[model samples]
Target: MEIGEDYRDAVLPQSRWEKRKFVRCDFTEADLRGLVTQGCTFEECDFTRTDLGESKHDSTAFRSCVFDRTVLAEITWTGCSLLGSSFVDCRLRKIKVRETDFTLVSLGRADLRQCELSGLRFREANLVEANLSGARLRDTDLRAARLLGTDLSETDLRGAKLDADALVQAKFTGARVDLDTAIAFAAAHGLIISS
Candidate 1:
């Protein structure tokens, strides 16, 4: 267990950590590229300006963590839980996620364009103004997620589980959706769909 430790500007690349717990740790400006962690828990940790590119995590929990200006490109997460985490201005290009839970997480104004986010859970997440253009969200769960001003342009929302309120709140210009979703959107906007 590492609590309240300051690892700012530290270089720890390609490290393997398993079943470790980090609480309130500061990883500002650190280089942790290609790191692998499994079943690890990070609570209230700050990852400001940290480069975590190509990191692989499985079954890890990042509760209430802050990722400000963090480089998370090419990261792979499987069965991980990011509950209550907040991402601000982070670099998330080419990130891969599988069965990850993002419940209550905040991703306001984050750019996740063209990312493959299929089958992930975003229940009650705050995604206001987030850019999800061209992302693949097939079979994803987004129930109760805040979509105010969220860009779903050219994004695929087929088979996604979301409420009618979410459809009416998000921007869906040029988005691909199934017939059920389209009908729901129309109903949410008070449009009479006969046929």
Candidate 2:
């Protein structure tokens, strides 16, 4: 267990941690590339300007953490929980997520273009002004998520669950959707559909 520890600018590459607990830890500008963690919990941790590239986490929990300008390229997360975590200006390219819960997480203005986001839950997540162009959201749950000014252009939303009211607020230019989603979106905007 690590509590209130400061690891700023520390280099801990390729470290493996399991079932460890961290509370209020500051990893600002730290180099944690290729780190692997399983069943680890990090609460209120600050990852400002940290490099966590190529890191892999399984069943980890990051509650109320802050990731500002962090490098998360090629990171993989499986069955992870990032509840109330906020990511701002983070580098998230080639990130793979599976069955992750992002409930109440703030991803505002994050660029996630062409990312594969299947079977993930984003309930009540703040995705305002985020760019999700060409992203595959198949079977993803985004209920009650804030999508105001979110760019979903050319994004595949098949089998994705989202509220029609939320969908109306997002930009859906060239977005692919199922018939049920299309009908619900049209009805939410008071559009009359004729059979």
Return the TM-score for each candidate structure. 0.96, 0.97
Off by over 4 Å in 1: none
Candidate 2 runs further than 4 Å off? none
- In model 2, where is the ten-residue run with the lowest total lDDT? 159-168
| lDDT (Cα, tens digit) per residue for candidate 2, span 42-158 | 999999999999999999999999999999999999999999999999999999999899999999999999999978999999999999999999888999999999999999999
Candidate 2 global CA lDDT score: 0.95
In order, what lDDT does every prediction score? 0.95, 0.95
Best by TM-score: 2
For residue 38, model 2's alpha carbon misses the true position, in angstroms, by: 0.9
